[model samples]
Target chain A: MKGPRLTEIVAGLPAIVPFVGPETQERQRGRPFRARLGANENVFGPSPAAVEAMARAARDAWMYGDPECHDLRAAIASQHGVAPENVLVGEGIDGILGLAVRLVVAPGDPVVTSLGGYPTLNYHVAGHGGRLVQVPYRDDHEDPEALVAAAWEHGARLVYLANPDNPMGTWHDAATIGRMIAELPEDVLFLLDEAYVEFAPAGAVPAIDISDPRVLRLRTFSKAHGMAGARIGYALGAADVIAAFDRIRNHFGVSRIAQAGALAALGDRASLDRVVKEVAAARDAIARIARQNGLTPVPSATNFVAIDCGGDGDFARRVLAELIARDIFVRMPSVAPLDRCIRISCGRAEDLELLARALPDALAAARA
Target chain B: MKGPRLTEIVAGLPAIVPFVGPETQERQRGRPFRARLGANENVFGPSPAAVEAMARAARDAWMYGDPECHDLRAAIASQHGVAPENVLVGEGIDGILGLAVRLVVAPGDPVVTSLGGYPTLNYHVAGHGGRLVQVPYRDDHEDPEALVAAAWEHGARLVYLANPDNPMGTWHDAATIGRMIAELPEDVLFLLDEAYVEFAPAGAVPAIDISDPRVLRLRTFSKAHGMAGARIGYALGAADVIAAFDRIRNHFGVSRIAQAGALAALGDRASLDRVVKEVAAARDAIARIARQNGLTPVPSATNFVAIDCGGDGDFARRVLAELIARDIFVRMPSVAPLDRCIRISCGRAEDLELLARALPDALAAARA
Candidate 1:
């Protein structure tokens, strides 16, 4: 029997999820993880106010959400000091990345990103049939200069960079990013993913310039605001670029509960600050744990830490596997050199305690 | 500055929202509608258990939902007596529609749909650069035969049919749809949108046959389950067709709360039956109200009724405006013939009473 014909791009693409969720892992293992410190989810949870708002909004789930995301966009604009027209709210950073790719990267187009950077971003690029030009990381950090150079070399349509980078948890200062932006080709759209920017230190976040159409800044409530399950994120860009999303985006894709929860979460600055503080403390504790276990921890600006396992990629793999077997979930970077480190998200003290308890045994097993 | 370059398809299309949400209207009017009978939302609300499940899930919103939607898909599969591979849950029907369009529609591909059918479906077609061949409705129902003819005429890649049709609140029986499916070309995909099928008359829905590779049946919790704001929907089809969705779908786009709510909603058969009954009563009340206002009510097997205002599209539009002015939210079809009718969703008795009180004045104002 003949099947539905997929687009040439999609037909050629392999079916794979960028990251398997911990739930899937739990289901496979037939047991839940002791410490869910893998996905970089804010284990601190959303603000009590946001939780209350979402719970309350649950009763009103009969009504579809505002398609334009007006109020939430307005609030986000007010917070970011940009016009509402410059902001586009979507399902999540993942969803926004897909839209951004669709907007610019047609089939056979060239796109640039760090090697072993965000897999989901690459997934969107490949899903759109974009030929990806990968720039190897410099000292485990996304090398901005090399990215721009590759974009120019490849005549890339888009360049993706995650500030306070994922997996490595390293960051470039605002001035450094500004310099990179200045050096980029005018025609190449820069997708600046700042999903973990909430945990970045002061001066790490670049100033928002809505006039520059070349840059799209992505922010999500999933990290610092702790609403990952809500699947709400926003992109800040030039008015026209933001407006172009309406041509293709699912208008009501952002749910009422998500909007309400994100709005409430954004308003709760005290909760955000508290979570940041908690994340910082947890990061330090994770670093201390690494040191105590004879591993070196990478300095991090984000909520997660990458610990050098003092071994090769295969050893790191074994460590990861042993951790998973111990019911302690953690992920490591993909590819050589970088894959020698395991990434751990900030967790509550009890969660960290479980991780700390598992590390020695896991490391010993890897050594075996 | 050079802006982000859009895909040729997106660049050519105007940035227009398919539907102007009621919230947008509320913002413009600076007042909330007393009766919201537009959008075909179920005013009976979600099952209490579903609401409770969502409310409870809200607290755990820090972690992303399972990317594979494992448990929910299993539940849906068992409920439909299909394999989990046959079900693909997404953000909503809107989201699933977008993915479906992306899956099969390459630039310049031909697509067939009823004129004045779901605008969002047309929007997706346009977004994907699909050439839409619209078949005019026969009587008030979407002409299955005409659609198939048009598909053959245009060499269409996909044909869209909304069973228990929107706006006009019309439908065809199972046999007619089965015949339509049988007539479709082997190369053409059939996108059967059953968003309103839960409220469709008994025997109106065709039996699920996952063996049919060309047909995809879309279902949603947004209608009879009263979880529109949750933005959760699923598509059932041949395992391969369903699997193709993962090639481009935002894996974690379905929220945790949405999964919990939908799972719980599906389990509460008593609540669903109650909602279907209440909606039938509401439909009758709406028809009575239309008759009281000297208008004709179209026969409906869905949650909404289409009231023919004894006028043309222009007059119907004016009546719609007057209803808006009277704090009643109702919608009308976009094209001729169907445009002569104003569609009202099933609402509670009080909301219908408001509609009853407002209709006469709205009609008179339009006449003036």
Candidate 2:
């Protein structure tokens, strides 16, 4: 029954997935949900061109993708007016976060993130045997100042922040973020997850120099470009830091179809603009729905709204369970206080209608 | 200008990709190859059903794929006659190899593989700081007996063998492999890579015994299933060994579109059978062409044929270069003795015609 012993780090780790898929829940419930508004997926879908490109590339799936992600990186570079060396395209921001943690965090190394920020990042830190030092959120936003102070206090090797943050969907202005960047220890690497950046206001992303070497900015096709299923994302950083990925990454990990789809998605800025607008409108609709249900929806810069249920985590959990029971799929935060809010993604009008129908009943059921 | 220092292991490793992709080569040469018979890609492509499935899934690209890969695993398990709990699908066999190496190899741990076996596996071992103890191929095939000896001699944590191996298109029969497995150290994990198993002869795959904790079998949709670009592969092992992946894997790494395409691919056995027949014919055609050119084609048990170029490694390299120059993309091994052969994949009839026309000139160029 015994096999080769796993590395001490791996053996000590727990078998855990950061989030459970709605499909798994559906299987247990024995019925599919009418509204798929959880996971913050783009209900509007990817650009027509991207879809066509992936379809065409499907036949060529026999060939492995370019290990270097040449075409996609070239397109991203041209779009951002940076050298191709500045980018490292990976499976997704999630995958890149794992790789980044592997590169910098050795056993017992200190890493920092806001409490209840992104569990996946924390998951990676734990996987690598790093010691996680959490800075709690300020007003439901990742407190930049607290994170920097903790980095110095802990002599942390890495610090993570998600701009236009998930769960709470709050954001910090570019100037504030830049000042936070200025105060950070030069030895502490910053992971600026711009996963929701495209949906944020124009001035939200700091104009930091890529040559600074202290920061890695992660951008994904999952959000604005609506290619989450393609699993394509890139990190922008100093050339040396970027090149470090070549040493350890599964070189041919990115599939050929994903490369083609992401490249096409990057080229179609018009479609991205349209998605941003649609997401904004959907966010507004969700906020209104929350108000109608006697809950307060936190104003969102991202594609999802977090509705405070004005009670404990258990009440929010009940509301979420009731929503699911009524064929509406929604998620909530895992940690306390934040867990008092239920998270709903922006969806199509019909999907929102299903949510509207379910919300009041779910709230009443939870109250009962 | 400083960032967090990479861990001593990562900092000491070279920032290099094991293989330069064909696209990168094409970019460097400023022209695309006319016949891409390199990389052992299925030139005939995937099933129409799979293509259609991916096209349909493209519209749903906004959602993250089920992190568990539920449907695909169910389909694969049913096809393979194993429980879904015994299966662990990954980005590709390449990705799974990386994870396996990471699980077992700590700093300075010894691992064993053929001297010239899959470089990507070796790359993963080195990335995780595993000391690679290579046993050279005996004759043209990987010598399983030698590998077992190496494992015991080094007290290696893991041993890797590719049945119906890559680069050479050679194989060791199941009985031979099973006999060697019996002799392996009880505690040494065995990575049995069955990437080309579908193209292998009947009974080539050892009998499935999920209770054997020492062995993990890796199967890929990339090869025979023609979904390489979709990046789906699975590993089968004892429940405990299989479950270890959840401790460290990027949960949402696989794409929703990929999962859909792979599920469709698995359901269509007729398509797989057809591709197998085509692959056999293509292998025969390659062997015939090699004979006509006064070369010896190594006996193959896989989709590709390795043609002995009747010269040294340098001559084979020159021949490969000439074939690439003539737009008939082909590759050769990196090590001695094995490098005396040029590897060519099974392609469409038109592609073979191009190869036929180009081989003589390429041979002459190599001789010169």
Quick one: best TM-score, which candidate? 1
In order of listing, the candidates' clash counts read 0, 0
Docking class of 2: medium
* Residue pairs with clashing backbones, model 2: none
lDDT of 2 by residue, A1-368 (tens): 56878999998997655568889999989999899988988988999999999988887788898888887898898888889999999999999999999999999999999888888999999988999998888888889999999999999999999998988999999999999899999987899999999999988989858887889999999988899888999999999899988988888899788899999988888998999999999999999999998899998899999999999999999999999999999998888879899999999999999999889999999999
DockQ agreement of candidate 2 with the native complex:
0.79
lDDT string for model 2 (B88-109, tens) is 9999999999999989999999
| Reference A-B contact fraction recovered by candidate 1 | 0.91
Candidate 1 chain B — worst ten consecutive residues by lDDT sum? B10-19
Write down the C-alpha DockQ for each prediction.
0.83, 0.79
Over A63-104, each residue of candidate 1 has an lDDT whose tens digit, in order, gives 999999998999999998999999999999999999999999
True contacts kept of each: 0.91, 0.87
